[model samples]
Target: MARRYRYPFNGKRFIGNKNSMEVHDLDNETKNCQIDEIKDEHVVTFIPDTLEEAHKQGFDNGAYCIGNSRR
Candidate 1:
């Protein structure tokens, strides 16, 4: 059987095969974002915060692992 999943954001639920999560600053600045696949996978789509932060967080080229494994 295919896996099913739901992501909750601001008290709302989004259903889909792919989940795009984003974090924006108070002034509407995009901080970091990621796209999660339904098969328990995720990829970094955007990390406009900074390259230092991205490197500190161990993300390469704005793409990396999701749960525990590297993508």
Candidate 2:
């Protein structure tokens, strides 16, 4: 399974995926999912020139993950 990370900010939750570059949008997958604290920091790389771009990517990743929880 592809490891997924959640970045919660500004009263919204954002999802990050290694396979899909950039941050996606907040989705049910993240909003309703349980938070599993990881001792090892999950590294999420955002290549976007601005924070907005990264947030957008995270939102997409989250929305997409809801359909594929098997990941």
Candidate 3:
């Protein structure tokens, strides 16, 4: 099934939760990422559609989805 995004702001490859401030790879998200678990109010779509942009907004790489090794 195709995944449906809430904001889909810039159609970026990454998705993040405002509540947790964690960003995940939309194409490679794992079950642990819990993209579906995030509330609609917490869902965030980056404007620039880049990891750096997300980071600039205080979002961090998802430990489960975006690789834990990289901070």
- Give candidate 2 regions above 4 Å deviation: 1-11, 17-27, 30-40, 43-52, 55-71
Residue-level lDDT of model 3, residues 1-71, one tens digit each, is: 12464364334577888888888877776788777788878878777777888888888899876775345
Ranking by lDDT: 3, 2, 1
* TM-score, one value per model: 0.22, 0.25, 0.78
Model 3: CA > 4 A from native? 1-11, 69-71
| 68 Cα displacement, candidate 1 (Å) | 24
Model 1 regions lying over 4 Å from their true place:
1-48, 62-71
Tens digit of per-residue lDDT, candidate 2, span 1-71: 22344432322334344444324343434533332332223424444433365555443434343443222
How does each model score on lDDT? 0.28, 0.39, 0.74
For residues 1-71, write the lDDT of model 1, one tens digit per residue: 11113422222122111233322121221223222222344422223444344444554332222223234
Tell me each candidate's RMSD, in Å, in order: 12.1, 8.2, 2.6
Ranking 1 against 3 by lDDT, winner = 3
